[model samples]
Target: MAITGTSSFSVNSSPVFRRDVTSASGNLKRNLDLKRFAVSSEQATTSSTTTKKFVENGRMWKKSGEESETARRVNVEESERNGKSLKDYFDEAKDLIRSDAAPPRWFSPLESGSHTRDSPLLLFLPGIDGVGLGLTTQHQRLGQIFEIWCLHIPVEDRTSFADLVKLVERTVRLENHRLPNRPIYLVGESLGACIALAVAAHVPDVDLVLILANPATSFSKSQLQPLIPILKLLPDQIPFSLPYILRLLEGDPLRMAADNLVKGLAPEPTFGKLSHDLLTMSSYLSVVADILPKETFLWKLELFRLASAYANSRLHAVKAETLILSSGRDQLLPSQEEGEKLRLALPKCQTRRFDDSGHFLFLEDGVDLVTVIKGAGFYRRGKYIDYVSDYMPPTPSEFKKIHESNRLIYLATGPVLLSTLEDGKIVRGLAGIPSEGPVLFVSYHMLLGLELYPLVTQFMIESNILLRGIAHPMAFKRLKDGKLPELSTFDTFRMMGAVPVSAANFYKLLSSKSHVLLYPGGMREVLHRKGEEYKLFWPEQSEFVRMAARFGAKIIPFGAVGEDDIAELVFDYNDQMKIPYFKSIIEEATNGVINVRTDASGEVANQQMHWPYFVPKVPGRFYYHFGKPIETEGRKHELRDREKSHELYLQVKSEVEKSLAYLKKKRERDPYRKMLPRLVYQATNGFTSEVPTFEP
Candidate 1:
């Protein structure tokens, strides 16, 4: 006969079956009789009809009350036998533990009045035969001070591990739709810990993960070999149920009842009889073990293999904040040192040790356990998106999109220097000077101008800042206004995070948090005389003094050393006025036009290889040394003091010259200087050149 909610049993017949009890000690009457009975005939008939409605109607309270009535019996007996207070037993045990065995203690529960639902959602997982009942009561005391959610793990293969994950995804989606958005936390015990880690790997949104008494390191086929066969065809002899089959298959009914009780108390738990409740938990585990598969030896072996793999597996990499809680005094798992080893492997994770508690710390620590888990910042649903492959900005298409959207304009507003040391060598670079004040940065411009790459690389990687600059009219014409179709917003490259400001809003843009780039040298820097390779050519009409004075910003002068040495900057200012041949050449070269005459001397200027290149000095290494920050605030009205601003600008210019000379000397004997050809074309501005090979 099938039995549900087994209530009370005679202590004379069963030493193992124990109940968790509640009592009104020092009251008028102490004698209260306990009895076990199945649901009445009429009640049984109504159960099926009521089950769905009851669950849907928030009848968790009813379910827990019923379960608790059954679970409390053993505890009542323990209190009577011990006579002393339950707290005294725990306190005594706590004091006697060896120093080496002490595990970390759970955090004390915050006062109920101090709790808020704004806390993140935390999911709890129980070990083998772990029903969440008892823990739920403890959690309730905790939930009063923190919001928490507990879920039941299916023992039966509702689906394979892969399919199971999909199921969880669906559940999460459903829950998100049902509730407000929030982050979620996950805490798993033993086997559940493995599942939790697996879920974290797949679900990037998980905030923190708590593991309890996991046996991953020591669990192998040998440990599970005896039980594998029955697992393959679970509930063996189901249709042909017999007495013998039942006897061998029965598990701890009381413990199972206790698990149900814990789950019922979700969001809050009663922890007065915590120790007695824990002792009774072992019975439920025993029952769960019996019903698990154990038929044929081969099938059992397969089950064991699968279990071992699942337990041992780990996420390849995790980026979310995480916490690992392990018990040094655990009976099932090895020493907490095993957890330490796992922590070492996951260098990014935070960990806490509990020496006093065993595998079931949730019971031992009770309300404190809830406090610790809740503090890690758990979320339930709707707070964050599921792990999307496009979240990282490194994805190629995403990166492309962001670049297109951000429109980083390299502005050159000064005399540009270009040079070369030999034939077939091109050398070119830029020096940027910024005006002090939190004003927008506007420098020079280059496209397919070779020097553009080095300038951008220096600003991004070396300076570690997202730079924005104003594009020349010609540069904008080629860009076509960043209107590329077939781009995804999910892609990081779409530059959704960047803003494309115009010259009309230049002042407003300068007032923002962007580092503006401008090239005042314009086309004048590209046109060089035959033998004058390294020369600064400035435009007659430049906006430097006007912009610095208007914004009251300091002028930070930076020099581009090798830019003039690369290739002759080929362009015609009147191309827009219907100049056919020159316009076509400009168009071709601007769009990566090649085969044009290369500046032999300009090539030598690129030899100073740095990161991305991994190569040492080739021709010359570009250096961007930031001088002291200039203070130019409140000078906006001092427009007539042009020479005063110019003097400060020259000081910046002098500093740039000093830094350039220092970089050149430092790279003179670097190994990359030996690999001439590989340093340029193959490495693209020598950004990612391979390190030069050396002869031993």
Candidate 2:
């Protein structure tokens, strides 16, 4: 019978084979060939020449001088006993098949020089014609790495559907009995795949069930329509049609086996077997030049039924590990969507499809088959991604990869100048700030304390900088009412590595990575009793002298200029008369008064603690400048040579004054400038100017 189609190539038509004009065998080889079936003469000769490949009989016939006759006989007897045991096992296997208790017997490759067992037992179930010589030498070679078991079902030309199912059940039971404790896997092709699935359902021991080119539905009355016209014709008209049907009967040893034949076809070149099977319901198997889906209404109907059945069946919920390979180019069964639906139904199963391959994915992409099988235990497809859109846990490996790929970043709030620029474009010192030393943060304490939060959060979280602040004892201690203020929580400051140093421990803090953010002006600058605000108080000279001698670390004189202009203090401190006991305790703790003179020689000794002062400028803006670090490490402890340290400290203060002047000018041109017009009106309305004690 001749099958003329693009799928079947004529080797003789090529230049390499033009010179060979051969006989029937040669003609068959040249015109149509399963090329892998051809074996070399040398290999055939070598195989034929070998009677027993191993020295199995050597122990029975050993050297005479090596041992006594009785001992030699005992060893020979033991060897023969082992051989008999192997023969007995094979006999039992064959008997099991004859009695319909098991499928066909499979031979495992012996462990020898070339035959190494790497993979486990992989049982293959064939459709129709049980086992054929179509398998190539390469297939056998692969067996050296993995044990191959080919299953043969008990369905002949006349078997019914019920009988086929019984055969499958018996075969599964036999397999379980034979490999009682061992794990075995299944890979089924075409109708054979259907039988395997059935067997797998009955056998809980089966590790995996691989279905290849399986139909979407059973090929019974409706799908057999394509063969109807040809069946009406006699054997002489199309002799091969009846034989093909007989072959399909062999496939029916299990339910739905015959159905696999109808759904396997797809138009893609790689899926040629399936495509060819659908086109010609004749003896020949080859691709048709043109395909017409309209000609096979029965095939389509059967497929739709099969797909629906599989979807509705309990088999979809089978616990056996499954991997479904869909054909992207499948012309049969609406491959992509069907595969997707199947995957969704079987959420735990893995699904993969090839755009280049079709229904016969195993044949065209067998190399990938090895990989998929090896990875089956770990494979999980259609995994949900948790991206605020879904509920899935983030993978640790993915998190690590993202973390490694991201660059380290540091962000600071309020672009402030650290040093003057050569071109006069303020060189922002955020990135350039030295991370290693003791940094005393001297800044203006803005009213309402709103500016400090961003500064603190950014310093600790965004920038790698530790902070220490010399807060007032009043700020750190719990309120007299037994409740802690929100800002005074130790937990908040501890997370940021902030240490609130008392006046006694101020030196330790200033010596560490202690960035002491302090406002020397304190409450004196903050108080704008009746008519004064936005002005710096006449700072006590002792406040500057005491801070300098306390730490050998650099004194970073800084300021925060804007805030007081927002609200003027309209009331006096006496308005909220303190409880006498609380007032007495505070006064006792602070020494003579709440605020007292630190030095008698300094100009600030003349300033009274209750006096208040105010700024004459418009209440529009304020600024703070961070002067260079003052080197107080070399200074002595004596109050006599405090003159030199005082002179250097005054330089830092002058630099701060210069920065404040620059900021005032900057405020004039700055687009973000705003004024609290109400504070301006109150300041103009003769608000009182009074001072309260601030013990920072």
Candidate 3:
């Protein structure tokens, strides 16, 4: 077929293809042309290659081919001697393919350069497309650590969903037999994900861990079900066009075409020239075009049927531990609901939602998916481990580095004044903090959360305790491009033993008897707008109070003030929202991930609001005060009562507010609070300036 600028597949020729292609814009047609050109070029190169033939010992021999008949007979004898028959070799090949008549194929590893016997077997099942080539990016990265096996179903294999399940079962059984002791991970994306879950359910004895990405189990019930009738009407020999299908799939066509064009011209495309999504989609389309034939009507129908057939009933039989990676922006299925349903049905299940991704989340966000997989302990050595004890405590070297950074910050931002209650009286310099126990420091997050450096480092210096900070979920999440933002605070947060804020993580930390830091105000307090400094945007519910009571933990309410002095807010929420692009970006970032600020007047209305614009001012001193530890040891019974628990929650909020008010009032008394005075004192006394403290 000639590569054409416009897709030759007539919209009216096949009703199914027509309905599907109705969404395809002119951009999609151009993309298809590019893909076809690439394929045609590859075919041309292959066809041009000549095979050398020669006669060796009265037998025909090819220079670029295998050994002669005598050599083959000797090899056969050697194989038979080793208890191997032709059927054994045939069966081995069949394991990778559907049948004996099928073309010979082998599982392609993620990495082709190296082979490690100890690597875990990761079987990847493709989505409805059945191309099995969309995960090239994943394969490239994961193959380095895993024995990646992507199943390539033949285009002509029109097996029913049940038979497909059997095929997967057989493959898994063979792999299990080959590596009896080693762990096997079955990874499925979209349609393949549903198949993987079904296979897991059928083969109860086969020890397998499932990693499902945007499973299509809910597709039949989703908004896409309306398209099934149209798909069924498609002709048997409907023309295949990658761009047309991608556009129908709601993928960005123009960008994909542009990216493919760049790749075709340049072996290595420059990063940042094209958006990551465009590049990923382009690569996916290229693979799909290469593997799938033009007439995909039957395959499409089969996929739809399979999606409809695999209901929640089958999911109940899945005994293996499953990790569902749901995409919030999934165009093909109801990923979030499907994931939740699957989680409920499975005995052991964990769900993670990628809010920024679509149906091709695995292809677009491969690195982040890998990180989550590793974190979940899905790909471990030998047997599967239930829990991943991967939390790294702050090392001595990290402590030293943090201490040095803290000192520098203190010098730059002015002396950090620390105060706490001692014997019902105000005391200075961190004397009130307890030396041990499950201490939970509930603090108001300062603007940009800069207070963390002084608070955590000073406590470490004084008490020799590394505080495990409960941070925002954003701190642990990778960006939309499957890579961590350069110079992001995430690295710092992780190195300092900061875990993403979750009830489970909190409980784990408390149960382990570790010092934990929590900010009930969360992102709202840190990214507060102008005139909102030191304001507590704490939630009304007192869930943490009950949790603290359960662990009998010491809850110390603390607060900090200095953000107003350091910088002036130039743009508030209203100002930022006025910019259409900025507002859209914010919406995109938080869409389906978390609820954004909705109320305008409520205390927690703007709690989800972030992105405050600020300009630096004269450097100012930071002040912190930790209230008397509220011992929940004997208050476990009171926590059971909602009223009492809420009262306790209010009390903590009040204490944090009180600490902020006290700091604001008393900071005026500090001699070093003003820059000129401290500068003169420093100039006169060098490093030995005796700054006067406030009197109680």
Candidate 4:
């Protein structure tokens, strides 16, 4: 549920509720109410319909929304959950707890939204609450790409932890057998995360992706230590334990919810309004205080203890690709600290932290699971993730978010953009570049690739174009050695459609007629020496021209200069190599990083990953110029000839150098190229006003 919305939404009492229990491969035998979690925000809604036919014990039950009421349910539910809020989850969970259900079952929410034909099966295992409805906030977005199934372990059901694992394992095995090629996603939270891990441990060889939020594996060391003794001593009929249980869960559910609600709110917030909402929410949670009464509460706590022990013991056996989402303010567990520990423990694992979030990370207002998966480049259709195919283009909201995140970078290095049309007329923005597909922008990578944010964001904001950057493998690959911490910055790059650099990916981008951003100079230019600023360290051979010509891509040779203006390289890769300590660190860091240009010599082949220490200067402006697009439509056959390809490549390189020189020279004439003048100009006018740049 998002706390941030334009209009208000309220959860009414006496809402519809689904039947108490379900059978395995659950059918709607009870004419259940199957309550839909309604939205408490004004977010836009979208729907999807699952069309795959089912084969149950050789009997074909072809249930599809295309010809049935399934589609209607999807529409109705999606619209209802358009902007799910914390209250919706509480309401649905309250309904589940109130119903006297038995046994654990897997059920597909007919309204789980639609998915692609090749969408992998995503089985959600619920947290301690055991309703499996924890993903209510993320249901609509997750539905867009995953065939969803949710595991419901009834609050009243006293299923042992081992049996729970068996049930999930059985479901995983059966699904894998049916769709062997597709990777099943195990989206788990807390206790559910433990179940997912145990299943992964049991089926080590199976293809699976685990997305665990606030995993309870660290429960043994949490503040819940005192609860274990109390839980064991409590009698079955101790109805007075709800407040104690809630206390162990967190300090105060109302306070926690209220504190996190105003975070990331839209259109700003007033303290007075939030205070009123906080009071109202406090009353709401109190109304349903005993959702998990004595017996069920004790059962969940015991399950957590057993599941944690079970999963932690077999950590070595679990081989599935795992993403751990750790919340910083998680009072129930030390999730933030545990994330770092888990990253080292798992063979194939990565962790993303939400410092402001709590134990119920998924249920929190600001968290978006789908976006996190996409940013982490975890979405895939088959056994392997093809960065190019799995890349999800950023939505308007995402683009704006990315821009705002890097806004300081923009202000720190004020960017001035210029592009040339086919007629050689220079324009202030992207107006001169062709607004079409298959356009390859080959730019000189500025120092540390500092120009990237400005370039990518401006292209999206100014020209309404998305630049699919060909990036380094470190952005996509996880280094198991833990020699260097994973680059969290790359998450934004992946979110903005940056694919790992590879010959195949380049071909895929061009073949798909997508706009591609390439840095032919690669890391050689990005992490250059003290004196190599604005210098092109491109490969000796024409690696990209032939491929670009084959696909008839428009190669736009561009240049961005001004790294020297913002900072001076006090220590570089060359300097690091000279010192023994730094050299060892570099070797260890790049040990697991992908080897690029292994057979090549010269500066262009130097693909070592190292951060050059630099000293900041007075903030200066960055200048970018895109030269005229070199047409390759009719020159494919011509470029197939080696001489022609090399000739064209050299021509592109020369143009890039020319643009660099042009920007270097022209910026000298601009009065507001430096920070102080630009600030003064904007201050005199409006801070939101665009400071003037050199005349195009």
Candidate 4 displacement at residue 285 in angstroms: 4.1
Global fold similarity of model 2 (TM-score)? 0.31
Against the true structure, candidate 3 has what lDDT? 0.60
Instruction: Note each model's CA RMSD in angstroms.
Output: 23.3, 29.1, 19.8, 7.9
**Per-residue accuracy of model 1 over 1-696 as CA lDDT, tens digit each:** 233333222111221112211111211111234321222344345433331101111011112122221110111111122222223323322222212121111111111111233444455544443232224334434343234433333233222344433434344444344343555555666555555655656665544444444434444523344444544555554522122222211122234346647678532233434435444333334333332323322332343345447545655554444556666555445536656655655534545566555555554532244324322222122344211111111112322333344432221211123222224132332223232223333332222233444454344433333343443233212222122221122122112112222344345434442354444433433333233333333332234555555655554444444433233433323422256754454444444312121232342122111111012122323323333334456666564466665665555445545545543454454444233443444367554433432121
The prediction achieving the highest TM-score against the true structure is 4
lDDT of 3 at 145: 47
TM-score, predicted candidate 3 vs. hidden true structure: 0.46
**lDDT digits (tens) for residues 1-696 of candidate 4:** 342212111112223222222343333233224322233232223222434332111111335444332111122223334757656666666655554344677645433435555778998998877777778877777776787778877656888899889888887887787679999999998899999999999998789999998899998987767866776676756654544434433334455556656564442343454455455455555433545666676678788899999999999998999999998778788987878888889988889988766677776666788779988888888889876666556655666778888888898778888988777899888887777668899979988898999998888777667788998887788554645656676889888878888899998888767789999889888888898898889888988998998888999999998898999999888888999999988888888788777888988877887888999999899999999999999998999999999999999999999999999999999998889998888789998888888887
Best by lDDT: 4
* Best-to-worst ranking by lDDT: 4, 3, 2, 1
- Residue 552, candidate 4: alpha-carbon lDDT: 85
How far residue 156's Cα lies from its native spot in candidate 2, in Å, is 70
Superposed Cα deviation of residue 474, candidate 4 (Å): 1.1
Per-residue CA lDDT of model 3 for 545-628, tens digit only, reads: 998898888888887888777888888776868899777756655542333334334565454434677898777777788888
Answer with 2 or 4, whichever has the higher TM-score.
4
Separately for all candidates shown, the number of backbone clashes (residues 3 or more apart, or on different chains) is: 125, 11, 1, 5
Q: Tell me how far the alpha carbon of residue 198 in candidate 3 is from the true structure, in angstroms, after superposition.
A: 26
